[model samples]
Target chain A: MRHTKIFVGVGLLLLLAATAWGSDTDGVTQETSFWIGGHLIDTSDYYKKVGEYRSFEEDVWPEFGLTYKSTTPNSRFFFKGHYFDRDEMFGMISTKVSDIFTGKFRYNSFQRQTGQDLLENIEAREWLPSVPKGGGKILTHDITDPDADYNYNRKEILSEFSALLSRENNLRLTVAHRAIIKEGTEQLISNSHCFSCHLESKSAKVEDRTHDFQAGLDTKAGNLDVGYKFGYRHYESTTPTPMAYYEDAKHPVKGTSGAEFGSRLNYDGSSMPIDAKPKIEKTSHKARIKGAAGKGQFASSFALSKATNKLTDLSAKSWAGVFNYAVPISPKTRLVAKASATSITADDPYIDVNTFREGKPSAVDFDYIRYSVLDRTTADFTAQIFHRLNPKTTLSFLAGYNRVAREDYPVAGDGTTSSTIIGQAKVRYRQGMKLTTSFKYRFEKTSDPFVSGKGLFEVPGDALEPVHYGYDAATGDSLWGYFYYMREDLWYQAITTEPTDYHEVNLSSTFRPSAKTTLNLKVKGVIDKNGDLDSLDVKHSKLNGNLSFTFMPDLKWVLSGGVSYRMEKSRGPVAVALFDG
Target chain B: MFPFPAVRGDSTIGEIEHFGSLYTMADYETKAQNVYLSISGSPTAKLRLSSTLMYNKSTGEYDQVNMPDPSIEVSSTLVDQDFTFDDMHEYSNLDYSMIQVSLGLSYKLADGVTFTADGEYADLTDDAGYVYGIESGSLFMVRSGMKFDF
Candidate 1:
């Protein structure tokens, strides 16, 4: 709201000033433009998707623009404002002063419509009439506010300033700030199972904000340029967490055996907050240096950052170092090399869930420490060489290696590591100025790829045989054994869509038969597979093609057309557990 | 084995009779295409016209590959029913297409003055509706205004 007020006030001021000033006075020149218009929108059926990113309300709007330039001290100012509606608008202002200082400010606001899921497809029935719960029921949903419409308003403001601190040393100082705000209401849905397949939805208010600030200073020292930057970001949500009442777990139909059901649930028969957002703060510092080394140019940077969640008092810290160099081996050949390493450490928190079946005879403790997957160390190194075969042809080759080591992941007290080797080759040819073609091929081989630990399907040999239990004499119902024994021995491992081997190819061509006509074509393909999967042959492939043409046969007409197509396929495993017990 | 009536046992008869489930492979495929055309021209020194049309369509589906029958691992009488994996595909399937067209005209009414008008139309078709239902609709918007330069 503050940015909106500022935008309106500035627009009025600029309008008045431009009206009072002459078109040209002395060495000063000014241009001003204003427009007033109204737009109408008509929609049929569901309009949310049609007007997803726009305000569909029919309303009048105004636009204003001003540009002022002065030659005496070399200063220029530009401003533009478009007010479509209360929820949709854009404003921008940029200025240059004395060829030493530059500043820019921008504000934008838009509306987005969100959908509410009814969740009507979750239903189950018991076909056996002799069972305890003999009846069948359909899934039901309740909407607290059925007439409520879900939409959110997003607003963003960005401002940047740069100034020449020292002309002799070519030193510059820059500062920038950005803020984003989202405010609206959305539908919150929660479901409870085991007792009844019931879904409940309630309207929840959402008010979130994020702000970022950065400042940097750079200066030249002999043949090198050095710079340092500091950045801070904060995100907060002021909306109150929505509360839901969980149903007391029991038999779906008979509503008996409450204790058996209650033991399986961590919380029930009480109202608790759901989907609460956590406040976060992050800060980073970076230093970069660039200069000439021998007959080449080199640049290096070091950065460190830390982020914390204020709600939980948990924090993560990361540091990274990078180096890059480019040198010309000969007049027609050049080589570029880059290396980077990053390390991250995050606080591990202990989970304190209620002991499984707390007071029951079959109670078991299930609490454990939580290890973050974000705690990892990564390194990458790449070197590329470019050679010009002739005046019309150029070739480039690249080789790279990447390694990632995750700490206390998948299993506690053990770490998982993955490494990949990458190779690529590219060639470009130009036949005069009429046509240009380029082709690229890339290959990657990964070892010890990341896996999901215990989330995969078990091999037939590793799965424990089903246990048989006698029937219950009172109810005449069959007693079955639990599957935890089988689950504990499951030995197969599954990947999280990470490919162990992959190949990619891309080809593109541009043709300019004449100065007024041009054509472009591109094709890309990729295939990847993970052969180590025990029960699933994981494979993926993608293909894409694009073509475009532009023609300007005369000064009065210009035409352009383009088309693109893409296809992707993947084969993966989906495991479903049997919950008969 | 327990002899007491209603007494819980280490293993349930229901789980032992029906604890048969297997992981199956799913083939997921998606295809998308986009086309756009634009034409702009100045018929006269004081008049300019521009038009653009864009269309996009995408479709995705998931199919179970070599799904095994539950009866193969458990007694036929105990197996509740055969699951049709195809029925679950609708939850993840997608079929959507959208088209947008826009036209703009600008004419110099006088020195340092111009008139501009713009109109746009968009249509969306969601054939494979999921949780949000079918979001098929069409919208048209038109705006006209004047500009001045000094």
Candidate 2:
């Protein structure tokens, strides 16, 4: 088999070499174009800024991906693949605020709210927190204050696959599949989930997978050319039951009672007090439809293109479209205008991984909630104009507005149908070949009912027990505990965003200091302030610089190095309670 | 603060637990792809079977080392790092390889059930690392089932 493969490889290589040698630059000749490329990414701190216990740690590493393409003027095919593996150990310092959807509680003792403190210090250190008896009772924990030292460490593996195809008439198709599998949580277990001594005796594992596919086609009929595309994406996941020590006389102290306890609870083959379950296998199916219909006119100094687009939801058969036109008005002026309406409807299930890690009741099952299909219709229009002020200077301006009407079917809670209006304006300029700058501002206003799934703050509560009080055998006392269900306010609220703006300026130049090579230097800095109707102060700033030595152009190979520093912060007003106190 | 607390469900609701004497979960075996093979039993043939122990730290809770068997009759504690216990506690052999010597006859029943009786000798060795023991058992598989075309 090895020899057979080698023979095939050599034969193919020879055939390709012969074909290249035999080709002639003659009329009506057949041509084959070959290309290969790939990209590299390194995320040093992913999801690290959130959560008390850091879930993952990392070291600077390298991952290699390869892509190949062979094509004629009208037909082509390609394949690509990538793999990444690593062992990470770190603590989760802060939880992503989004994880509150799982109904997990996280209240600090000293920060308890006015009416929600339910457990004493010693009573608060058990496996699971207690809740009020009534089904509709809403308890809040004080989390207005921040705690910074919490963290948890985890290990993981990530991988991906991709392929592409291009048929006659400029038609193209691409597909990709990606997956991440997490194994070994031993390091994080000590601080997160483990039975004291038994911690050394056990470990936990988790797994996940995703797939994405896309297709694009373009063809010309008479003077009208059309371009269309569609995409699909899906994700699936699973995790087994993770156990800590069961309870016994020698092995006492249940749950995360702090790090000082000598022994953890032992299972001793008894029923688990908490309602622990594995990950709900959630699946998401996504489909997208996009297309452009237009005609193009080419000339020596300028070109113009105009088109109207139509898009539809295949599952629901509801659709809309926009009209767009781009024209080079003169040697120094160019303009583009676009307007369209879009509709969306779909059903997807989301998983709360934090619930599984904390061994709490998960909010991912069908019975917990079935998100009804959503129907939203949005209409927007934009116009952009650019001017070549001089041989070395250029300027561009942009303005746009959007309005959305959203409706939720089978509304479950406080969600409401409302409308929002959003608008933006921007300007960019380039001086000579060294300096480029841009400034933009955006604003939005909406009147809608908001439902915050997780807590922004809360006070801790009591230990969860069956209708009958359950006692810890070793302690010979009932387990009483409480943790705050962190929550943010949700109400019929009117909100606005103003001066959500940003500016970027970059300087670049290339100098041929030597005959053999030219060196290029570039530096850029940007400040971005963007947010939704709930808050207007989400912002970040970044400064970056790069120097490169281009050794070749035809072969397209360059050596470059760059570094970037960024700071991100968000500050919003306190959420006012909706219901009367 | 919100008016009513949201209700949540466990993600692992439909998962099956594998531990103790239970080799499979309810309704799980029905999905297995079934295959059948013919066998002959003879007195002169010799076979040997061996059993080994596997350590899975992540599969079960540490403090409760018994792997959470709600069906188990006794209380269970997590095996210490050394995996030692104060009492006569034992675990099932999840790792096993068998070789047997048989002196019997081959008889295939009309309804696809193959039944044969033969005297066989076998030995099993297990090292839970913390707990070491050597035990043996007979190999007997009575597979009686019907396959439908659909």
- Candidate 2 residue B133 C-alpha distance from true site, Å: 40
What value does the interface RMSD of model 1 take?
A: 5.3
TM-score for each model: 0.90, 0.36
Candidate 2 lDDT by residue in tens digits, A1-581: 23323433443343344334433444322322221222122122212211112112233233333343333333232333332323322111111111111011111111101111111111122111132232222222222222222222232211111122333443333222222233222211211123322222222333333333334444443444554545444333335444443433221333333322212222333434232322322222333233333432321111111111111112332456656677777877887777777665444334222221122222212224445445666777777778877665566666766665555532544345444444555455555444445555444444442333343322111112212123457986654321122121211223332223545666666666444455665666555543443433434454555554533332223222222222222223232111101
Candidate 2 chain A lowest-lDDT run of ten: A101-110
lDDT of 2 at B140: 22
**DockQ (Cα-based) for each candidate:** 0.48, 0.01
Instruction: Tell me the TM-score that candidate 1 gets on chain A alone.
Output: 0.89
List the candidate 2 regions with Cα displacement exceeding 4 Å: A1-202, A206-219, A224-324, A339-380, A404-564, A569-581, B1-150
The per-candidate count of clashes, in order, stands at 7, 78
* Residue range A1-581, candidate 1, lDDT tens digits: 46435544554454334333322344766677777666777788888887788776744455433433333236666777888878888887776666577777788999998877755454456444355554643366787787777899998988777778899889999887788999998899887665776788889998998888899999999899999999999898888778888889786766877766676677678788888788999999999999999999999999999999999999999999999999999999999999999999999998877665456334567777888888899999999999999999999999999999988787765788999999999999999889999999999999888887765654332234444444557997675443343445654555678999999999999999899999999999999998777657899999999999999989899999999999999988866544232
Q: Considering only chain A, what is the TM-score of each predicted structure? A: 0.89, 0.42
Docking quality of model 2: it rates as incorrect
